[model samples]
Target: MSDVNLATIDLNLLNVVATVLAERSATKAAVKLYVTQSAVSNAMKRAREVFGDPLVVRESYGLTPTTRGAELLPALRAWLEEARRLVAKAPVFDPRTSTRTFTVACSDAVAIALLQPVLRLLKKWAPSTRLRLLTLDRLIAGDGLARGEVDLLIGIPPVMPPGLEAELVYRDPLECIVRRDHPQVRSKLTLSLYASLPHVDLALFGDIDDTIDRALARHGKAREVAVALPHFSSIPLAVLETDCVATISSRIARAFAARMPLKVLEPPLALEPIEIRQVWHRRSETDAAVGFLRSLVREAAG
Candidate 1:
C-alpha cells in the first residue's frame, strides 16, 4: 500500500463507508447519515478512487461489502467512536470523590451567616474537597474572578462588578443587637430611642459608609458610633461587654443570639435588606466543579 497521508483524505468519507456497510444499502445509510442517496453514492465513488478498490458490490437481495470494504468497517467504526468521545461535553462532577478546593470571596459576616452552613453540607457530601474562604473586596473582586483566584463571590457590595453573572442567594434583613439586659431598650425600639443609644458598627471595609447610617440620615436622626470594628466576629462580643447596640443582619444577629446573651430586635429604620449574591465569571459557565459548588451554596442559603 502507498503511504496514507491524513491531510489529503476526507475522514467523513470513512464514516459514509462504515454506515453503508453496516446498513447493507446506500438508501438505508443515507437515512441514517441524514444525507441524500446521491451523496452516499458520490462518497463511495470517492472512496473507490482513494483505495483503488470496488469496496462494495450489489448482490441478489441487497448490497454486500467486498474484502477491502469488510476490512475497513471495523477500523472506521473504531475511529468514529473515538472521535465522538473526543468532542463530547465534560463529564458530570462527582462531589463524593472530587478533591477540588474551591475558593470563595465574601465579607466576614457573610462567612458567618452563609458559609457556616455551606461548610456543614460540604462536610457531608464532598468530604474530600477543600474550601478556601477569602475576605471580600468589591474593588478587586471582578479581577480576582477573571484571574481564577476565586471560584465564587458572595456578599452585599454597594455596586456589583461588571461582566460577571450573579444570582440572588438570599436577602439578609438588618436587625439591632444589644446585651440581653440593655437598660434603655425593652420589647420595642422607637426611632428616638434607637438614635439616642451608642452604636457598635461592623465595618467590612475600612471606611464606614454604612446603610444604617444612611437610613438614619433620611429620618433626620443619627446615632453615636461608639466603636467601629473591621471584623463581624467581634461585634457580638462588643455588644455583650458594653451597652452599645449594633444594627446588623438578622441572620448573624439571631445566630449570635442563640449563643451569646444578646437580643435580636427589628431595626427602627426602614433600611433595605442586604442582597447576598453568588457571583462568578462567565468563563466558568460550563465548569462542572464550579456548578456543583454553586448548587451547594444555594442549598445552604435555603
Candidate 2:
C-alpha cells in the first residue's frame, strides 16, 4: 500500500520474504537460498520498512511472522503455485484445436481392440488432429521413428526396431470365450473337450507363424479350427451366436463379453501373455502434438 514506485522495488524480494516465513529463521532461509544470513536480514528489514510492519519478530528460539506477514502468507503461497504451473505447461500444444496429423501403424487386431476408445479420446482432446492408420501389410522399417512415416504403432511385433520409443499399452493373457448357451460347454472346459470343439481361428496378424498353436502342439494337443476369420472383431460375434469357441486375448475377450452374451473361461493351456505397445519414432520426441496424442493413447488404453 506504499506510494513508492513499483519499478524501484525488486519483485524477487517477495521470494525472500516467503522463504523466511517458511523457514521461520533467517539462518535457515540463507542456507536454502545459498546467500548469507546478513543478506536475508537486510532484505527482511527493508521489507518491514516498506510494509510499515515488523514482518518477523525475534522469538527466544527463532522468528515468527507478525500479523501482516501472517495475513500475506496465503496469497504468497497461491501466487507461487500459479507461477509454477504457468512456467511448467507446454507453450506450443493446445489439444482442443490442434491440426497436427499422424500416421499410426498397427494390425487389424489392435484396431478392433483399441480403435473405439482411442477415437473417443480424440474427440474429447485433439478434436482437429488427424489420425491415419496403417495396417500390418504396410508397416516397414526406415528412418528413426521420430523422423519416419509411422508416427505410432500399437501391436505385438517380432521386433521393436531400435531408435523408437515404446511402452506397454496393455497386457492381455489368453482366455477362451463361448456363447452363454453353448451346449458342449455346460461347465468347466477340460483339455479333451477343448480339443473336441470346433474353434474360430483368426488368420490375421500372421497367426500361421505365431506361437499359440505351436505351443499347443508342443503339449500334444490341438483344436479343430472349423471357422477362420480375418480379425478378432468378427470372431467374438461368431462365438456369441454359435457353438464355435474362440481363444482370444483377455483384453478383447473381456471387452466383447462386457456387452455380448458370452462367458470368459480360463484356458487349459498355459498361454503366453499378449503384449500391446504404444510405439513412436524417437524423431517425434519433441513434437508437442505427437506427445499429446501419445498421452491420449495411454489414457484410453488404461
Candidate 3:
C-alpha cells in the first residue's frame, strides 16, 4: 500500500469518484453533478492518481469499474451519503399534496387483483400520488429492484439478485380453476380426473412450469395443454371457453370467480403454497416516501 496520508486526500475528489461509480459514465456523472464532461474527466484523472488504480474502463455504452474500483465503491458511497445527509438540506414529503410518482413492478394479475384498493386509498389520503406499473417478467423484477429502476416489486419469491431485500406480502395456495358449469367440475376432481382433463397452462416468468410438471410426472400423468398463455388473466377465459382446467393462485381465481363464471377447486396433489413478496433495493429501505408506499401495498394486499 502507498503511504499516502488520509489528510492529503481531497474530499471533493471522492464525490466525483462516487458519482462516476454510481453512473458508470463520465458524461452521465457530469450531467448529474451539473459539471462539464471535461471537468469530470479531469477529476477522474486525479482520482486515478490518488487511488493508484485505473478505476474505470470504457465499455460498450459507458464505463465499468475495475476490481479495485469495485472494492472502493461501497465504502465511498456510504461515506458520501452520510456526509450529504448531515450537511445537505432535506426535502419534506407532503403526501396529501406532493405530486410524486412511484414505480412498481408486478404482473398483470397482481395489478388487477391488488391495485384497486391501493388506488382508492391513494385517492382519499394522498390525492397527488401517482403510480406507474411495470410488467414483471422473467428475472427482470429482481434486476429492476436492485438497480432502483422500480421502487418496489410484488410477486413470487424465487432467488433474488444481490442488493435487494424481499418481504413476504401474502400467501395463497394454488387451486384448480374451471368453468362454473364444466362437466368434470360437477364432481369433486380426483387425481385421475384432474390429470385426464385438458389444461390451460399459465407460465409466469417461465418458472412454475418445472415444479408443476414434476408434480404431474410423479403421479404418472401429464396435462394436455389446450392453451398456453403468458399471464394468469387469460387462463380463466381459456378455461371458460374450452374444456380446460387451470392451476392458478387462489387470490386470482377467487377474484375472477366473483365476476366471471368460474369455479375454484382444491388441487389433487399436495403442492407447495405460493408466497408472494414485495422487494426493493436496500438504498431505498430507509426513505420515508418508500416506507409509506410499502405500507400502502401491505394494507391494500391485506
Candidate 4:
C-alpha cells in the first residue's frame, strides 16, 4: 500500500463520514445534511474510493460499521469538533435561559445521595437546564464516557478508563448497616460478631465480592454472605426483612436511615475509605455547557 498523507485529503469528506457514522443511514444523513439522498450516496462512494474501505454496510436495522469505520469514528468526530470550535463563534451558555440537557451516568447510591441536592441547585441557578440521570452498569462507565453517550460519570475513580479526566468530589468512609431493631445493634460489633452476622452483599460489576473478601482476609475472617444484589438501594429493604448486615458508603447508609428503620455502625475493622469522583471525557473539558454542569455537581457534592 502507498503511504498516503492525510494532510492532502479533503476535510469536507471527514464531515460526511462522521455524519454517516452518526446517522448510520445515507437517507438519515441526507436529511440531516439537507442534501439529496443521491448526494449522500455519492459522498459515501467517494469516501470508500478515497479510504479504500467500505466504511458502513447495511444491517438488519440500518447500518453497521466495519472495522475500519469503527476505528475512524472517534478520531474523525474529535477532529471535526475541534475544527468547528476553532472557526465557529462561541455561544455563551446561559443556563438560566437556555433549555439544555445534561446526561449523567452513575451508580444508584450516588444518584440517591447527590442528585436531589444537584437538582435543587440547578433549579435555583440554572432553572431552564434539564437533567437526566442514567443508572450505569459499572462495567460500561468508561465506554459510555469515551463514546460520548454520557456527559458525566460520578463514582469511585481508578475505575475510569485512561484518557478520561476525573475530579475528587468527596471522600466518604465505609460503614456497616443493619436493622435498627436487630439484636446485634445493642452491642459493639467485634470482628468476630461482624463476620458471624449474615451479610447482604452488593456486587457492582460483579467485583464487590472480591473487594470485601480481600478486606476480610486482612483480619483472617470471611463474611457469610446470605444475599447478594447489584444495587445499594435494595440493601435497606433486604436488611429490614432479614437478619443481615450490609457494608455500604456512609453517605448512602445515612441517607437510607433517614427514611428507613436502619442502624449505622462503625465497622469494627479498619477499611479503606471510598473517594467519589466526577469523571468526563476530555472533549467536554472546555465546553461551556459541560463546564457549568461540572461546577454544579462539585457544589452539590460539597
- The candidate scoring highest on TM-score is 4
Q: How many residue pairs clash in each candidate?
A: 0, 5, 0, 0
Per-residue alpha-carbon lDDT of candidate 2 for residues 66-176, written as tens digits (9 for 90 to 100): 999999788888887888888895667788878878788887678767789999988887789888888766666443354577778788766766777788888888899
Best-to-worst ranking by lDDT: 1, 4, 3, 2
- Candidate 3 is scored at a TM of 0.69
The sequence of per-residue lDDT tens digits that candidate 4 reaches over residues 1-302 is 78988887766888888899988998898898899989888888989989899999998899888999999999998998899899998788898897988989888999988989999999998898889888777327447788887889898755656779988889899898899899766646788888889999888766555677787899899888898888888889999999899988899999998999888999998888898888999998878888999899999988
When summed lDDT is taken over every stretch of 10 residues in candidate 3, the lowest stretch is 137-146
User: Which 10 consecutive positions of candidate 1 have the poorest summed lDDT?
Assistant: 135-144
Better of 3 and 4 by TM-score: 4
**Where in model 3 is the C-alpha error above 4 Å?**
1-86, 138-142, 206-208
**Candidate 1 per-residue C-alpha lDDT over 1-302 given as tens digits, one digit per residue, 9 for 90 to 100:** 56889999898998999999999999999999999999999999999998889889999888999999999999989999999999998777899998889999888888888877899999999999999988776427456887888899887645665668889999988899999999988988899999999999976667775677788889999889998999999999899989999988899999999999988998877988878888998889889899989999999999
Better of 1 and 4 by TM-score: 4
Each prediction's whole-model lDDT (CA): 0.88, 0.81, 0.85, 0.86
Find the candidate with the highest lDDT and give its number: 1
Query: Please, what are the lDDT tens digits per residue for candidate 3 over residues 1-302?
Result: 54768898877999999899989999899999999999999999999999889999999988999999999999999998899799986577778987889999888878877889989988987899899998876338356776677898888756777788889888888888889899767747898889899989876655447677789899888877777888877888888898899888888889899989888899999889888889888999778788888888899989
